[model samples]
Target: MSREHWEPVTVFTGGLKPLPPEGQMTGMYKVRRDTPVFCDIEGLRGDAQGDRRVHGGPDKAVHLYPADHYTRLAELMPMASNLLLPGVLGENLSVSGLVESDVCIGDVFALGDARLQVSQPRRPCWKISHRLGVDAASRLVADNGLTGWYFRVLHPGDIPPDGALELVERPSPGMTLARLWALEQSHRPSVEEVNTLAEAIGLATQWAQRLKNRADWLARNV
Candidate 1:
């Protein structure tokens, strides 16, 4: 496989205000387009994460959703197709080419002048269903493993809306976002699987710890 592939960033979205009260999603719903956003170790300078507890931090400095997934989702859920537009799902960067299956944990990429590392697969929540007004939106994302991915800023810089995201490094013994999502959804993940993921080089610390805890629990139960 090619060591690196480039993708065009289709949109750059940021917002400080919360979503509509009726939706009950409550987080930067009004994502406006910006030419280029200043990325720091924390995140976008102007972007605000409505719920800091579950979203945003150094580990999840940026949220990236595949532009291709939107098209697939539109076909799957025609009723909520209108809500599948870029930034509607609260992603900071919407890009084409790199999808869950292609992106691996710990992979490093140069996005414009900014450098980033893939941290974890996005864990879809109730907010997604609420935002789309479809009760199964979250479940669908989980099942399909199209939940997007998070990035941790390695070298803070400015990223343009149409910037080219180029993979710079891909670590060995890596786990793809799609595989990680599948392991997470498994009713009973093998101890080896849990241990492997827990020790994955590029995985987010939180996810790694969670996998370790799950492994411990299974060891105890079995």
Candidate 2:
């Protein structure tokens, strides 16, 4: 596909405050504005991730969610439709055009002056449901494979809110985000499938290791 087919970033967001507590869970959920944000190997310079154990790392420097998905989600879960706006999902970049099916692991893109590579498909967590006040939202994301993807910064630089993201390179033996999500959701992926996923280029090291571990365990069990 042509680079012009790629989506343009609609909003860039970051938050200095923490997400308000609903029961015992709290985090930085409200990301605000289309400001100039600095993207380093770690993540957005000013952005704060409340739960460091599950977020904000070199491999997941930026979280991107497709703008189109929001409408579908709103229709699916009308109870929390008001909360389905940009940045509500704790994503740093909201873009149009590219969704999970279109993006592949190891695909590199140029966002303004910064270079980033697709790292992994986001594994939805309870935080999503907590944020939306809809207990089934996270499960729906996982089941539907509508969860967005993350990116690892290759070259740090300034990225404006309206910056256009263009594809730079795509690795061979393409593994699309949707495919990965399906593999993850499988009841029991074959050992060979796990091994293949672990060996895929452009996948984050952590995910590779997780797949490798699963393969090893499956081999031993079988």
Candidate 3:
């Protein structure tokens, strides 16, 4: 039991494919699954990312973009409304009743038999622009803090089709993904705040290091 009660709206998985005219590969075109999917330390079985260097890893194993975000996304980019849907952004799990501001960085949840920890907020990239066919798609998500969060598996198991995520622990209640993204977007965020956020429990190593670097730069330059 926790902040929001949410059942898995859908689970998605897909392999790499040419993005567009340029033929750049991307795995953002995930398809919804009606059957149970195996959750491993690496990720859901059959899930693949075009870019291993930045996309898939132990720290970024599973991605969840709240289904609630699509409405807001559509409001911001009406032209791309047709493309706004759960799993379209490459998320593995789609659920309602939860958004960025509702969960913290170190929150742990149990979905079916698997346990997952919030590792980092998903970073919006140009892929969103390509996926949505809107040049400002990525910027809109980033600027509005609509970017969802990622989950790193702690216990691998089968996630049933109708499974729900139940919050089991919250180690960094003050470090919500929304707050982290806001601080990162701030032109002159406090160095102390940045440093503290960099050390937030359960945050991804890459995200923590990036925050630390930002903190240092802010300390020296601002």
Candidate 4:
């Protein structure tokens, strides 16, 4: 029998609080995407907002993820759920099974009532390690890439507490954890190298350039 590989368990959200509050955040959270919230594309479409709040909406940006991200990371430690806390993200939206990091800029998934379009990987900050713990928090952003991707709301609505997630399409077709890691082999990737590699995977031209730029910077500095 085919085992159930991935399943979104829950979607947690911080009602309305400080985005990334400085401290252990508890309570005042909502079960954002449990077995219900369906994701869909709406509002902005086919654009790279990076770390800007252009994906979800002008007021509230949403971080959607599959549950496996937590189960796996939580496997590392219990308190890691501290990151899962709601107001910690001012509002979080968790899911089960799929690696949130694996979702790249442009990938699409159907939540419950709507769909979500991936914008970019979440760049790790010190706070993450603080929430998830030192080692895991540090490695999560760098290696796992399970950083829950952002989505632009094409449909205006809320993901009810009984929706299922569906994989519509991947934004970066060829961009996977393994492929993206290949860019770091030399510790410095050239523009041509970055462009060719990223384009090979169906990455948007501009987004490819952005990644290439990151590699170039890494190469020059590190």
lDDT of 2 by residue, 1-222 (tens): 556535557644555454345444333465555677788998877777777788878898888889889998998889999888877888888887778888888989898779999999888888788778788999998888889988999999988777888887888345788888888999888998888878888999999999999899899998
The C-alpha lDDT values of all candidates are 0.82, 0.81, 0.89, 0.48
State the displacement of the C-alpha of residue 95, model 2, in Å, after optimal TM-score superposition.
1.1
Ranking under TM-score, best-scoring first? 3, 1, 2, 4
Evaluate model 2: give its TM-score: 0.91
Please give, for residues 51-141, the per-residue lDDT of candidate 4 as tens digits. 3332334222455544555555665656655565432332345555556434544555555556555544444455456544455665654
Which has the greatest lDDT?
A: 3
Q: What is candidate 1's lDDT per residue for 102-164, written digit by digit as tens?
A: 888898988878999999988898888777878898888888888998899999998887778
TM-scores of the models, in the order given = 0.92, 0.91, 0.96, 0.58
Lowest lDDT 10-residue stretch of candidate 2: 18-27
Over 172-203, each residue of candidate 3 has an lDDT whose tens digit, in order, gives 87899999999989989999999989999999
Better-scoring candidate (TM-score), 2 or 4: 2
In angstroms, how far off is 184's CA in candidate 4?
6.6
Clashing pairs in 3: none
**In model 4, how large is the Cα lDDT of residue 108?**
57
lDDT of 2: 0.81
The TM-score of predicted model 3 comes to 0.96
